[model samples]
Target: MKYLVMVQGSQADYEAMRGNGSAQSPAWTEDEVKAMYAYMSAINDDLAETGELVDGQGLGEPAGTRHVTLGEDGKAVVTDGPYGETKELLAGYWVLDCASLERVTEIAERVIRCPQPAGAPVYPVVIRQIMEGAGDDVC
Candidate 1:
């Protein structure tokens, strides 16, 4: 089955991250950035070898993104960054085809075990099954 794994974060958490910035930024130490990326790259390599990984990518900070929705008149309504005040915002996602939910859970667990920047907590990874398409007649 195919699944979409969503990674979310909270506003307070993001604010703290923003303060940490990239290694190029004045806020983060070079060692800290290097360790973070090293861990991330290792995880990517593991996923590639597993064959369960379909596609995955990390996103830029949410402050640079926007949210758009349709209003009652069907016109587009745009909103500023991060979309909502919810405790979690999507940080990144991965789509994978796995043999069973057990397999998917294992993958998620591995992600949590991967190293992260010092002081950064493990973010939740939500797994959701994709809906299969019906024939044209169903529509």
Candidate 2:
């Protein structure tokens, strides 16, 4: 089965990582960021070696996002991102072909332990199994 594991962030979190501290969080040092990147890379490397990693990527800041919807006239209506400074946004994800939900859950648990500054807030990692087809199951 394939599972999608995700981690969320807010603009505040982004700013803090870039050395702009928010009232609720401290600025991350350069070393701290490097540590985080190295830790996550190690996990991905391990998954790839185990033949479980299908795809993975880290997203850019939410400020650059654009939203699109179909207008009443059947035209595309577009708007900039609505994520406020503190609003949560999808920050990164990994698509893993795993043997079972329990295995994916273990991976998600590892994601939650990614390195961060001591005062940084802990975010939850979400996991959802990818359906193979329409007849597979309804989520």
Candidate 3:
């Protein structure tokens, strides 16, 4: 089965990572950021070697995000930036082909352990099984 393992954050979190600390998140030192990248890279390498990694990537900040919705005229209405009221946004994700939910959960545990600055916000790592079918109604 394939699983989507995600980590979420807010704009404040992104700012903190860039050394602009706010009450919502602490500033991350240059070394601390490098450590996080190294750690995540090691995990991805291991998964790739084991054939469990289907795909993975860290997303850009929310500032450049675009929101689109259908208008009354059936045309697309576009808005710039993250969701109007959403405080948290997806920061990164990994698509893994694992043996079971338990296995994916184990991987998520490692993800949650990624290095961060002291007092940095801790958000829950989400794991969801990917649904695959052709109108099979596997909701």
Among the numbered candidates, top lDDT falls to: 3
By lDDT: ranked, best first: 3, 2, 1
- TM-score of structure candidate 1: 0.74
Per-model CA lDDT versus the true structure: 0.70, 0.90, 0.92
| Tens-digit lDDT track of model 3 for 65-131 | 9989999999999999966498899999999999999999999999999999988888999998888
* Comparing 2 and 3 on lDDT, the stronger one: 3
Per-prediction TM-score: 0.74, 0.89, 0.92
Off by over 4 Å in 2: 135-139
Per-residue lDDT tens digits for candidate 1, residues 82-111, read 655654667777888888988888888877
In terms of lDDT, model 3 sits at: 0.92
Q: Can you give the lDDT of residue 124 in candidate 3?
A: 97
Question: What is residue 71's positional error in candidate 2, in angstroms?
Answer: 3.4
